[model samples]
Target: MAGQSKLSELFIKCKSENRAALIGYLPAGFPNQSDSIKIIKAMIEGGVDAVEIGFPYSDPVMDGPVIQEAAEVARNNGITMAKTLEIVKEISGTGVPTLLMTYWNPIEKYGPAKFAHDFSDSGMEGVITPDLPIEEAGVWLATAKENSIHSIFVVAPSTGDGRLKDVTSNCSGFIYAASSMGVTGTQTNVANTASILVERVRNVSGTPVAVGLGVSNRAQASEVAKFADGVIVGSAFVKAVLQNPSDPATAVRKVAEELALGVRER
Candidate 1:
């Protein structure tokens, strides 16, 4: 198993502060590579505790329309795995713990070992593989351990207790607790079942739990933070940039600030 990574440290720090960490997500080359960097920096500046830079893939099974549209824009602008890594290096350089959110096919195409090495070299602390099942993650898990990068897995409310234990045991960083059964997007109400799912995970593993999906504003962040160790906001951040093409950085920064306050208030 890999030792404590920056991702783990962030959770520890958040716990010490009696608050949930604010984790924000955005595609690597959304809008454009140069502008994407600015948007991410704006997220950090606005008080995001950690960052998850998405590897824009054509087929993102877990992503909703908002994220899917952002990925399409990145792909149209020629955002390759190499370009994604460049963005990761820049964001990680800001000294805020950074992670990569990617699908399994890209890692398989890049060669699991090489991909892990390159990701760690880029200064990323972890990788979130939403579609990679624990049963099929042998090579990827081993490679992630070899490179000293945290392997994060996503668990949903629909996951069985037995499966939750299996998946949580393999997780090195925080466990991503999807707030609902469906794909990722903002929701008027974050499912009440999310707290139940978090409790179930706690019964099996001591890993920190971060809730994502349907959390868009400060109130939602505070609500999730009440039970989770971290609150993850993705679609809302992507939408901020998507809606404000002329000044995307400023738009995302404002959203980040609002969500940051949510985590702290909880």
Candidate 2:
């Protein structure tokens, strides 16, 4: 028998532990390169089980103000695929599974096969391509599969049952379920549709489901954790980095600790 993929193993571990996984996101080179790496380390040390580091796309259509601003700062700092891979390599050294969240264009520019190979060789476990449609994901999927890297696709409230099935069926990692039909950011409250979507996903697939978008606080994380196998906290953590750029590690640590506690509240 074969062993499990890194992502599947993480979800399985969390499932056995009776709590959702805390997945944290941070844009590489944000606030500055040194601070960005430190921030991610802080979260992992604080309790994050896995990480998604944004590669800073020029057009972040899927992200909200917080992530967009942080990405912009990273871009202005002259971040590139090379730099992002470097960050991923360093972060993965912590033994926490790390993923790169990038738009398809960057992957296209980098050459899908080359990007996947380089990423996997750098010690990262997966890639989350937001804009890559399932219909057009063959090349990316094939390349990732060949490298033993997980490919995660996003499912939204508007995702039809057939599409949901298609997306989830192709998923090697947990399916990324957007809580609401909007860009990512901090929300005043969790989207009611979040639970419904996760339920729908569970009904059709055994792959773990992770809920993201607009999860801002511990309470919201706990609420989503009730239904999701992994609670993804992005914009809120980016906001923490923005608030204390001079020394963001402590602030990011606090946020991750709170979210980790929330995920285990069950």
Top TM-score model? 1
After TM-score superposition, the amount by which residue 152's alpha carbon in candidate 2 deviates from its true location, in angstroms, is 0.3
- On residues 122-170, what C-alpha lDDT tens digit does candidate 2 reach at each position? 9888888899988999998888888988889999999999889999998
Q: Candidate 2: misplaced stretches above 4 Å?
A: 1-3, 186-188
Worst 10 residues of 2 by lDDT: 1-10
* Residues 189-212 of candidate 1: C-alpha lDDT, one tens digit per residue: 774878999999999999899999
At residue 190, give the lDDT of candidate 2: 59
- lDDT of model number 2: 0.88
User: In model 2, what are the clashing residue pairs, if there are any?
Assistant: none
TM-score of each: 0.98, 0.97
